[model samples]
Target: MRSDYFKNTAYVRKTAVSSSIQKLDKKDDELAFAKFFIERLNQFRKLNYRVVSSDEESSGADIYATAENLETLNLQLKTGEPGLERFWGRRRKLGSGMGIIDVNIEDLLAQIIRDSEKHYANKENLTLLITERYQPVFDKNYALRISTMFGNSSFKGIYIVKLPSFRASFPYEGQIVAIKDIFGNHGEVF
Candidate 1:
């Protein structure tokens, strides 16, 4: 059975999304990715989440959503490959032996902190969702790093949506690798 969300019959052709992504300059990629992500996210009708538009100047999250049993979620979307070095602390280049397809969990957390402090100060929870062009193989290790790093913050989760390629045949997919309940429970699955 094709239980994966991205495997839905009605899906965006990898070519369409990739070609579109390739044509965009860096400035517009965030918004473009946000739009694309939201469209795919809304497919889960059972979840009853409504994806709302956000204005860059005033919105803390790239996309906003409302659902039962939780406060408004601030989904701060980030794109591009994670850098080779951690933002703070010891600097070490990620060598090819470790693989180039990865997202820097530390840097992403820093951004979430900055964005949440500035715009999501009053919000209940924060999630940093990154959509990468290449498939990353380190989500499990990265999740453990995040849990150990920011175990006290209200930042509840980090999700990765990987779009393998723009070849029109590849499928776009995602998964919530790590999550916690700000209310006390750890590793809550969504």
Candidate 2:
């Protein structure tokens, strides 16, 4: 009985450690993405900005950025292609050899709008930053479509940061598109 108790305690300890490690890994990923996002935005817009401490992240914003001559902005960062899990599930059921998986941009936009409405309602100075790691294309059509979805969103801006796969040669830092501009107009790429 004592041996079983010891084993259970050990298992609990291992599980706790594993959970802590996972949390740390997630935090690390968020910090790395925030740094990359800020650097790219600064380069493109010629603005100086710094990410606020992680402790401030509990306010429903993944990141908080501060810049001179600008209001402190609350950034909700989402990574990964929206609806990617469903795509993978479909591919698996079809037996794997499916050539060229295409992500549905409309579905992605709809998901973002839903997330914005759910999480950021009545929040001022909030921006939705989606880091699409698998989107193959970020073009004018995508910008316009994304912008159209946010006609009544509470978010001040919606930006998609397209980080290409390891195969792309140009735009090593990836691309940024303003789906909805803070100034209340259709967005443009930086």
Candidate 3:
């Protein structure tokens, strides 16, 4: 329910972060998603941000963008069950660049939050979560609570973009981008 402080959390609270979901096994999805995100950011047509691949032990931020020598971090990726049908009742809250939020999103959200906490603690330079397309497990519960807490900014906190499911195995195809549609329009956030 805390908006302004969602990104600002006490150090004690940050040390206690954990998750149980398996590491994302699909690199194709990772690259595809990262590619799209990078392209989109680059398309902004301003100063360009640099994208860096994972290296040994450095633990550098994922995608770092810069303007006028000012660098920013972007942690864009997927979360929880690939099949979005699992989203039933959940809520998402957004805050400014430096804030603290007490809500949990998905498995990926947990990891991102945890990692960001670590990075910030180490005095690294990183900003912006850009966690759009977050699909909550429930609607009314989190929605009502988030609405009550955030009011007008509630919508800005989350962008419920429609995501099609990804198929693990496709025997009859060379390559395909699998997507599951709720109304067959490929599930755009309504």
Candidate 4:
């Protein structure tokens, strides 16, 4: 993938999001991967959830995994992490200018919460917007892009995650080696 051609480093940007998903690269493939990931999560059972869409929010979580599993809790899954990193540290590197980051994540987060609530309210189903998380190939804390929005307030920030961190948290065993590499030298399993 083209991501492989780039440096291992990660970047945090305030790039705008549009009403359409067409601008997103390989969206179909990404959705497919997200669905597959949701399936895997469901195999763990323990929780009953489904993939839901909110016209108000626009963005669809990989899965709506809900549970009383206090440890697991309720979550909205993203192909990548959802909460963003703070860009307060990047201001110094932008030639001592104003903050380098753009857009307020906190504001965006609020919009999501509002939309999520209003969406289900019409259906007469009470659903709490518990938490949002991302699933990335590499480091999570320092992912290539830590996109986030804090609801209830207009404050927002984004930060960059170094490559080294990504390498550490990446689900290597899940993707790097073939299924056989793990189950070992055995033949295919149906």
Candidate 5:
């Protein structure tokens, strides 16, 4: 089942890339990512949650999730790049001696905040799901920083899902860090 999940994720990612190159809409990608995110959430929290795509235009939520509690959570999904394109060009370079790659977490947070404000109209009961496309180094401190940064935001919860490298055999072997949640908790979900 786990292997099948990874294979499905890989296929969704490939489709997302192809759609991107074709300048087509990424509705399928958004739904697939939402489902994947919910699956991980369910596994980590031991909660049976199901996700469905929302009419973003009317609901201001990319996806909606519901659990046994009958409580619905609106999620605003955002995918971000590692901001390493400038160094490696369009195609990412894989090899040794790549040197240190600096990732500005503050800038990324700022962008997320901006995107949330610009794209979402209703923020009540809304959770932010940011899926980092490439592998970016994030420690507990960074997670704390993220929590602190979005603490006062309109979102009820905020989470970051960092994906593994493209070459990784276990694509789902990544971290899901919660920046903020209903219980006022923060840290790695795993």
Candidate 6:
């Protein structure tokens, strides 16, 4: 009985350690993605955006950016597999492949809606940007979906930026797409 108890305890301990490691890996990936996004955004000569802070624990936003116009772009960076569960407190594994990722529109919208309200309250001309790693595949109906979810809010816009793999690349090109009605106009591509 003593040996069995010890074996079970050992197993539980190992499992807990493994889970903790996985969470740390996810957080590390998120931070890496945030850094990559900031680097790419900075490449645009037209925009002078600065990274205010990159603290992982900051609940407000992963990274905060400000352009020359003094327009604050509160950015939340997420990198993971595609699923609605992602918006509801779940993290998916990021594949190494480089290509367009078909992200869940509803999930992304849900996150934007939740974060914009929670983070960007009272700030005018505030842009609550939710940037996802890799390309997010969305359809024409995405505009309507966003409009329905937005309701009444002070958030000026929600921008989704996708990009190539965060590797030393030969060529790079990316854009930030705004959900049309959610912002009332098209956002600039960086």
Model 3 C-alpha RMSD vs. true structure (Å) is 16.5
The model with the greatest TM-score is: 2
What lDDT tens digits, residue by residue, belong to model 5 across residues 1-190? 9999999999999999997866435676667667777888889778888997777557878889988766787878777655533333333445521334335556666688677866666765788887765544567776776677766777788787665455655344667778776557775564
Stretches off by above 4 angstroms in model 6 are 45-59, 64-74, 78-81, 84-157, 165-172, 179-186
lDDT, residue 112, candidate 6: 58
For each candidate, give its TM-score against the true structure.
0.48, 0.76, 0.35, 0.26, 0.70, 0.51
Better of 2 and 4 by TM-score: 2
Model 4 root-mean-square deviation: 16.9
lDDT of 1 by residue, 91-145 (tens): 2233343343334556665565456556556444556665565433445655566
Better of 1 and 5 by lDDT: 5
Of 4 and 6, the candidate ranking higher by TM-score: 6
- Model 2, 1-190: lDDT tens digits are 9999999999999999999999888777676666766777788678888988446435867778899888777777776464754665676678762345454555767686686677665555677777665434556665676667664667777777765346555334467777777655565665
Clashes of 6: 0
C-alpha lDDT of all candidate models, in order: 0.52, 0.69, 0.35, 0.30, 0.70, 0.54
Clashing residue pairs, backbone N/CA/C < 3 A, model 2:
none
Model 3 C-alpha lDDT per residue in residues 40-138, reported as the tens digit of each score? 445533446555555325653443334456444433333343422223222222323222323443334344445545545432233223233322223
Error of 2 at 23 (Å): 1.7
Q: Which parts of model 4 have CA positions greater than 4 angstroms off? A: 1-21, 24-26, 46-83, 87-111, 119-190
Sort the candidates on lDDT, descending order.
5, 2, 6, 1, 3, 4
TM-score ranking from best candidate downward: 2, 5, 6, 1, 3, 4
The best candidate by lDDT is 5
- Mark the 10 consecutive residues where model 6 has the least summed lDDT: 83-92
Error of 3 at 142 (Å): 13
* lDDT winner between candidates 2 and 4: 2
Residue-pair clashes per prediction, in order, are: 1, 0, 17, 12, 0, 0
